[model samples]
Structure formats: structure tokens, C-alpha cells
Target: MSFPEDPIACMRSLQAEFGDLAVLEEKGQRIAFVFSPELNRRVLTDPTNFHSRFFAVRGGRRSAQRRVTSGLLSVNGSEHRDARRIMMDVFAKKVLPQYHETIVGMTSDLMADWQTGQLHDLNEEMVTFMVRMTGALLFGITDGEYSEELGTRIDHWVRQNHRVGMGALVAAEEYTSQYEQLLQMADELEVSIQDMFRRHRQAGNSAQRPDVLSLMFRAQGTERELSDEKLVGHATLTFAAAHLTTAHTLSWTLFLLAQHPDVAARLQQELDSCTAAGVPDFAELQNCTYLDWVIKESMRVLPASSYSQRVAVAPVTLGPLNLPAGTPVIFSQFMTHHRGDTFADYARFLPQRWENAKPSAYEYLPFGAGSRMCIGASLAMVELRTILAVMLRKWHFQIESGATVDGRVIATMLGPTSSVPSRLIAADQIANTVPVHGSIHDLVELPSEARTAVVRRAA
Candidate 1:
């Protein structure tokens, strides 16, 4: 069967064929697909039983960079716990505050030189910014000139992994070729990371490490200091997870806004009122209700990862099926987000749906649910909020007339259908090059203005 890897098509087919869940086996391979909210929760809440060896790659379990467990995302059981603890130090409340400047500075810079009336593809430029910003946040690599170089190395390795993963899904005989390419790219990236890490270590006296590298290095007291191999492992995973996710999330948000000019107008008014005096701090981000709604609706319609999978270690029951051991159980956010049974007219994108709308945690697993949920969910929220606030405050973007913006699913993430959105443009060519002021909510297009306050809740 020629299963198209295009995400939207694949998801629609799965939903129509299997309702919420189904089982598929081919060539002696067994896979189970789960779209039910309850099952999504069960798989995550109790990951140990289901386990996570499901991500093991063929050339070996080592990451694309060939590092061992460096961070929490790749490991399971006690090792994951320990890595999480160490990484949490930087992500802890204290460190996030430190990031406020970095976030604002990055966004401000992007919007500063934007010019109006020029046909610019903000998605591509924004992706570069997000990728660089993630590297800066996680590894303290802020130099834009160097950001591209570093991002290139990281991107190469990630794409290689994606190629291999897709090959495995289709049982392609060329899997070995893809795997070999993945290993080669990983080796190249490994060297680059090592050099960077060494420099950061040598500059320890400067107290200038702005990324997670310092945190991992200092995580020694939390049971163990990260080894070079392990440090690269975690860093590589962070690059992949944090970079593309942020970029895609931002692009999707723009895409949704472009479709709803009225919503964009309201959002702009809200930000305008909220920021009459100055930019909104992390605290004020919570009160941007309309902004929040836009993100929610966007994710519901086109989440970065529409489908996630797991393997059952023991026979278990899900809905009407008795899933056996080794079944590749799959869960889909695409279907769940659009299930008419749960969400009315789920196919349509409606930000208002989230206003005064509170669904069960299970019903909205855009970030996945339970223990194995996206570790950077909170961080993503903050990043998204910050970027959106800055981008909207400085300039407004709309899908260019006749611009074809489509989606193609590539493994765990989504990419635009055409290269137009990915093109890089000077920021000076965008409209509304006005400097924003006061709180973000004040500047937004809200029906009524509201004061900005810090949102301290952890995601």
C-alpha cells in the first residue's frame, strides 16, 4: 500500500477508517492506533508499563549525535527522572525570569527593521529566529551569524533522523541508506557540539553561559555531572524538539490569524491596550485571553505532532480491542482535535471556541497527556506568547494574496507545502513598523482593555 506521508491526508484516513482507535499489522509487524482521549491519558500516565523503547533507532539506540542519555526526553525510568531534575534547574522559575530579556530582545530585533507593503514570507524568517532562539535559550548561542551555522549542523542531523524514521514506518528497503546518512550527519554534528561545549567550559570564569549547557554542567550536585557524550545527547534532543516545534507553532498561529483578519484585528487591539505603556512581562502573558484562544484553536486544528505512538509491553484493553504486546499503539491529535463528537464543527478553525471553553484535560492533548507529555510544553507557551506579542506589536502579517500555504507531515512535525514561507527576508520591508508600548493586552484588539499581570502557573 502506498501510504502518503502527508500528515493531513494520513490523519483524515485514519480517523475515517478507525474512529478513535484501530489495529494494523503488515509483514509480521503489529501496530495499534488509539485516538480516544482516555487511552491517550492511560498511555502517558503509565508510561513505564508501555515503556518508550519505541524510539530506538536502527544504527543503535544512541541519538543522532551518538550521545547517550543527556536529557529527560530520550530516557525513561530513573535516568529520565534524574536528567529532568538537572534540566529543571534552568527552566525553574528563577531562570525563566532571566530569559525574559533574551525573549524580548530576540523578538524586538526581528520586528524592529520590518517594512510594510512588501511581500515577505514571515514563516521562514520566523523559523530561523525560532531555531536560533531555541539554541540561544538552550545552549546560549545568540550570535546570528553563528546561529545559522549551528542551526545548519543541527538541522542536517534532524532531517537525517526524520528520513530514517519515515523509512522505518514504510518498511522501505532503502532504510539502510537513510540510516547511513543519519549516522554520517550525526558524526559531523557531534564534532561541532564538542567544540562548542569545550569553549563554553573554558569560559566558565566569564559566567556568561546563556544556554542549558551551563545548567547541565552545574547539575553535578543533582546526583551526577553530565558526561560529554550525555551532554551532546541532551543538547541534540533539545535542538530538535525546541527548534522545529516553536517554528511550526508560530507559523500555524500566523496561518490561523491570516485566515481570520477580524481575529487579528481584535488581537492587535488587545495587545495595544495591554501595552500602552510598555511590553508585557511573563506575568502579563496569561491575561492575553484572545491570544491564548488563537494559539489553542491553531493547535487544535494543526498541532505540530498530529500523531504520536507507543508500544505495549503487556496485553491491554483499549476501547473495543485487546491490544497485544509489541503492538505499535498510535494516538492522533489531528482526529481528537477535530472529532465532531467532542468538538463541534471540529474541522473549522475557530478561536472563539476556546473562549469560556474548558474541555477535559483528556479532550485536549495537543501537547500529549500525562507523564510523557511534551516536556517543553510550558516553555513553548512562554516562547509562543513572547514571540506573538512582539511580532504583533511591531508589525502585522497576512498571508500574501494567492500565496499557497499548505501543510505536509514529516514524522513528528509539520512543514509548509511550498518554499515561499521558508524564504529569508530583511525585516525592514514590513508594514506597521511602529514601536510598541505599555502592556501587550492593552495594545491588542480586545473588546475591553484589561491590566496585565504575571501568570505564574506552571504548565
Candidate 2:
């Protein structure tokens, strides 16, 4: 079957028609699609056979674009093992405390710009805020200029990659012409990453600096020291991985909370009761269970990184289909999380579902699973929790009734395609769900009428 302009709609259709596995031809290539958790396990567990290669066109063997994008997600076998081993220390539990301080500080910086009753495109606000936050966490924020410049470069490069690479799904020649533009941005991005590395090295504070770049640099003397080239790829991918997805999650979570007010009220109460001074400490966050449920449910329903593809390294059979080596296989977080059999009333935004729900990694993977799972998962959770708590505790948001909200799937991330216009209200004010319209309907199931769903807790 052929896909449409909206691939999410197509995937839903495929799920209904083909329960577990489906294969379709696009531009003379057979692409396999897997839906079930078992199938997801089979594909993700054996990365050796199903290698992760995201870009349809990787310029050349030594292209800057190819190298910069070759971090953990794109690498395989020994290289992945080696990289993951060294990077693990950088993302370890201990480092997250320092990272937490950065997240809180940057979020506070963004919040300082707000005025009540003012309207903002939440998507734009979140995206811009994340650029600064991701940069500070990746490179030192103390300098600000380097972080802003590098963050801007990586952010631009990612938008280019998504704009061109998504079209590659159809093998459209229209996208081929822009591949050079994508590579050109990569070249610029690589230079910025290298320059940051040199400055960080020259400063001789790798040990003291807690940003990810400095931490990676500090690990330089070990046998597992990553080369300058690998660090470039790591920093680039890490920023790309951390930036937009978290921003979109923040946007979607806020919108969803506004749309489901009772959930919002209960969540607000939890945040109000647990957090002090509108900012939550790590210890306070661990006890904010409902807030956790809200974040998990938000991700489950409108996951930012919706679907990803992997290429087979050898001939393999997925379900009833036999695939040759080098074939691209697909797995979807959106589809898996929406399964009726797996999650009852799965389409609705039910944070309560997570209260008693237990699904395997493959069944509900927002950050993916297996060995290639996102390295920043912990940091992402902390950032989301801290920011959402700080922002929500400080202000209640009301989505404008006539505002049009839309979502688009570019590359693997699903983000707002239009401005999510909303007004910031006093934190003590209550938020209400209003009727809205857009392609956002294509992504999540929303209430037909004004929703007043309340979630009461048991003593």
C-alpha cells in the first residue's frame, strides 16, 4: 500500500489491516513495519542484524554530515559498545544533579520573560527555551555565547535534516537537491562542535565543568577516550536528540493538561503540595507520583519521537515476510502505545492508565528500548519534571478557543506545525478545556465536548 502526506494516518490504517507486521514498497524498495512488542523486541534486541541507519543519503564515506550524525543511534557493534561505555559515565546518576541545576537555572531564565494574560505560541516558546537549555547542558552555559552559537548551529542543522530526510521516505528527487544544503549545515555544525572542544580543552576546567562536553573531555586520559571526531558526532547528536523532542513534550503536556482540566487540577495540587517556591528538588520530584503519571501519559499519547527505522544487516524474516539484507524496517511508538488490546481506551489522554498499567519497553517506548535506548532518558525526565513543575506551578495556561493547533512528523519527531496560541494565567487560576481544531486530531484522540474529567486519589 502507498503512504500519504500524513504517514501517521497511514500507519494507523496499516495497524488495523495488518495486526502485527506489514511490508510495503516505496520507490522499488521493500520497507518492513512491525507493531507488536514481540516484533519490537526481535528487531531492537539484535541490533547486529538490524543496524540503525537513519539517513537515506549519507553524502560520502568521509562526509561531515555522516560523521556528525554517527553517534550511538547510527553506530553498530563494537563502536556502539565502546561509545556507550564511555558515554555512560557522562550520563550517570551522579552527573544528573549538576545537570538538574542547569535545567532549573535555564528554566528560571525562560520563565522570567513571562507576563500574565500575555499570549504565546507555546511551541515557539518551548522550542526556543530548549535550545538554550540543551546548549547549557551540552556545553558550558557560563560563557553563553558559545552555547547559543553551537546550539543555534545544531538546531538549524537538525531542522534541515528533518525537512530533507523525511522526504527521502518517498525517494523524492525534490529532496535530493537539498541534501547538499543539509551537508553544508553539518559542515558548519561540525566546526562549532570542534571549536567548543578546543576552548573547553584550553581552559583546563574539564574536571570542574559539569556540562556534557566538559565531562566527555575530562574522560580523555582513559583507554576508552573518544577521538575528536567521535566527540563531534556525540555532541551534535546529543543536542539534536535533546532539543526539539523535549520542547514538544513540554508543549504537548501543557496543551493536554489544559484540555483535560481535572487532570490539570489534580496535577496542580500535586505540584503545589510537593514543590517549594515553584521549583522541585530531585527528592521532591520522586514523591510527585501523579505528576509522573501525567508526564508518562503525555508521552504515551503524543510522543515526540514517534517512529524510527533500522536497516537489516542480514537476511531476516519479520513475521510472515522475508526481508533481504540492507532492507529498512520500521517500529512505531505511537501505534504501539495506542493498541486497544494493549491499553484499554488507549486513544484518550488518561494519565490514570499508568497508575495500574504495565507494558513492556517495546509496548510503550517513548525513549525507545533495547541497547539503543536514549542515553539522555534520565536527564530528559528530570528536565521535563523540573520545567513542567516550575512553569505550571507559576502559571495556569488556557488555550485560546479559536486557536488552531497542528502537529507534523518530521524525521522521527512529532512537533507542532502551527503556533499553539495560549494565554498565561495566574497560577492560582483554573484552566479549562476549550474546543479546538487541527491536524493534532490526527495524532491524539481528544474529547468531542468540553471535558471535565476529574482524577481523585484513594487514601
Candidate 3:
């Protein structure tokens, strides 16, 4: 199967032309592309038939890159179950408040350089912000610069993997050449992680420390003992899972709010009503129902992960079609989210639709659905709420006029292709939609406020 140049647009077009299911021949093997909630539920629920194999390439047998890449998502069966059980306490609901304080403090540090009228690359800012925030949650590191250094290395390593892996898909020589660079980055990351472990061990009473790495350390030598190699895998996976996805979500949410001034103004009102001294704590964030709706609606409209990959382990029948084993299957969240049949006025950016809406787990999955759903989802929600609350309370955000806004799906995540250069407005000033030039118009329906209408006529 050919990877289309513009995958987001291509998927949308394919779903329109070929109803729910489309199959393609990848050389001799078949690949199933399903674009409906029912099909998604069927495929995801039947993991015995469809094993979750994200990519076909593994770096080397004993390489640090291989160890780090084979995290929780890559493992299956009993190993997956035991690892999930051990990691569950790290993200439990009761400990969320501890993580909340870290997010708020880090958010404050991030905005320390911001001025009233400064222009900034909003997407880049979010990426860097999440990298630090993720580090604190994962490693319990208080040093911002050190955290940024580690996070930056991991970020570069991840970007290389996405680029090189895609090239390997088609056996491109150009991408193959960069393969060694990826491994070298991984070697550096492994050393940093070892240093992290040393610091954790040196820090007294690490068993009581609550970061993911600390908790995971406490679990070592227990019934399900994880090797040092697999420990690297877990840490890398947690960082990768939370960092970019949450960052892109924040970027997209803010961009949508900027474009829809009415929604932004209204949400700010909710923030004012719910928060104390312009910053919402975890309790206050819970009460901001409208804020919840906005996040939900934003993810539904432009989800971070467009599509996920799976492989059929056993020969199976999917509806009218019969498929052999080893068939690669792709189910699109973008296609499912944009379906007009499920969501009325689906193309419009309307936060109010989520107020009375009751979409199923499979229907509205940004963190995804099924047993292998994202582990850091709860942390992500609290992080999003905290970041948005503090930022919106301080300033209004708007993209500069005539700036080109483009979104592309890379490494299974949909985010901006270039800098979303935007200027900050005073909290006292009202924001207006600007003239944006690019492909963001292809994915989202942006109408100026004067002519805007709610998805629901009653509103």
C-alpha cells in the first residue's frame, strides 16, 4: 500500500468514497483500513486475533535502542499484564494532586519569559513545556535545565525514529543511511537514564518518592521483576506517550480558542467563576464543566493520533471480508471523529456539542480505547486543565494575520508542520479571529465570529 502524500486529507477522501471499510494490497500481503466505531470496537476488542504491533523494525538484539523502544506498548500477554499492574499505582487518582502542584509550578516557570505583547512560536513553546512537565512527572527531577537536556535528547531521538521508520517501510536507502544516527542518540539516552537511576538511588527514601520512575523502582525485586533493560523501556515509553500528545493537544486547543473568540471569552468566564485568584487547583478544575467540553470538542475535531496500526495474528473474518494472518490493519480516529452520521455539524468547531452528547468510548477516543489505551491519560487531563487555566487567565492568544497554519500527521500524531507564530493579547482585551493562510482550513471549519453559528440550533 502506498502512503499518500497528504494522509489526513487522503483518509478523509477514502472514507467518503468507500463507506466504512477499505482494503489495500501491500505487495502480496493485505492491509485492512477500517473507519467506523463498530469496526474499531471489533478489531480492538479482539486482540487475540489482532496483536498490537506498532512497527516492524527493531534496532538490534542487545542494543540500548531496542531495550528502550520495547516499552509497555510493545509487550503483550503476561509481561504486559504484570507491567500494567505495577505501573497502575503511579497514575492512581489519589496521587493526582501531587502531580497537579508540579504541573502548576512548571507552567509558571514556562510563562516566566512571556510579556504582554510578545510574539512566540506557540507550538514550539508547548512542546518544550510538555517535555519539562513530563520529566518532572517521570523522574522527580527539580532542576529545570537538566530536565530539559534529557527531554530534548529523547525528543530528538523520537523524531529520528519516526522519520527513519517511515523510510524503512518502503526500503528507502536514504532513510536507511540515518539508521546509525538514531542508535547513537539512543546510546546517549541510555546513559542519561542510568545517571537518573544513580540520582534516584542516592536520594534517600526513594521508595516513598511518587514519580513514575521512583514507584517503578520500588516495584523492582517484587513478584514480577523487571530487568534494567526493560526499565529503560518503561521510562522512555511514559515520556514519549505523555510529552508530544499532550503538547499538541494544548497547541490545538489554544489555537481553536483563539479563532473562536466567543468560545474563548465564554470559557474565560467559566475559568473566572471556577478558579481562585485566576489559577484553578485540581478541585476548581473539576468544576469547570465548560472547560471540559472545550478540551473534549477540540480533541474530537483534531485528534492528536490520527490512526493506529495493528497486525492480524490469526486468520479472521471481518464482516463480509475474509483476511489471512499477518495482515496489517489500520483504524483511523480522524475518520471516526469526523463522521457526520455520529456528530451533527461535525465540521464546525463547536464546544457546546459535548454538553448533552454521550458518545461511546470507541466513538470519542483521543487517548484511544481498548485495553492498551494510553497509560498517562489521567495525568494528561489534569495537566491540560492546569495549563489552560493559568494561561487563559493571564492572556488572550491569537495567530498573526496572514500566517500560514498547517497540520500534518507524523509518527501517528497530528500537529502543526511549522511554527504557529502568535501574538499574546492582554486579558482585558477582546480577541478577534485573524486571516490564516494554509491547510488548517482543510481539517477545521473556521468561520468569522460575525457569521458563526452553534452546532445545536437551540444554542
* Regions of candidate 1 where Cα sits further than 4 Å from its true position: 1-4, 61-70, 205-210, 419-459
Model 1 CA lDDT for position 55: 39
TM-scores for all candidates? 0.85, 0.93, 0.93
Most accurate candidate by lDDT: 2
Arranged by TM-score with the best first, the candidates are 2, 3, 1
TM-score of model 3 relative to the true fold? Answer: 0.93
Instruction: Pick the TM-score winner.
Output: 2
Q: Considering only N, C-alpha and C atoms within 3 Å, which residue pairs clash in candidate 3?
A: 1-26
Worst 10 residues of 3 by lDDT: 449-458
Clashes of 2: 0
lDDT of 2 at 285: 82
Give one clash count per candidate, in the order shown: 47, 0, 1
Which scores greater on lDDT, model 2 or model 3? 2
lDDT of 1 at 208: 54
lDDT of 1 by residue, 85-128 (tens): 66666676556666777898888887666666556665677678
Residue-wise lDDT of candidate 2 within 181-216, one digit each (tens)? 998988887887788777767878677777888888
- Model 2 vs. true fold: TM: 0.93
Runs of candidate 3 with Cα error greater than 4 angstroms are 1-4, 171-181, 205-210, 221-224, 449-459
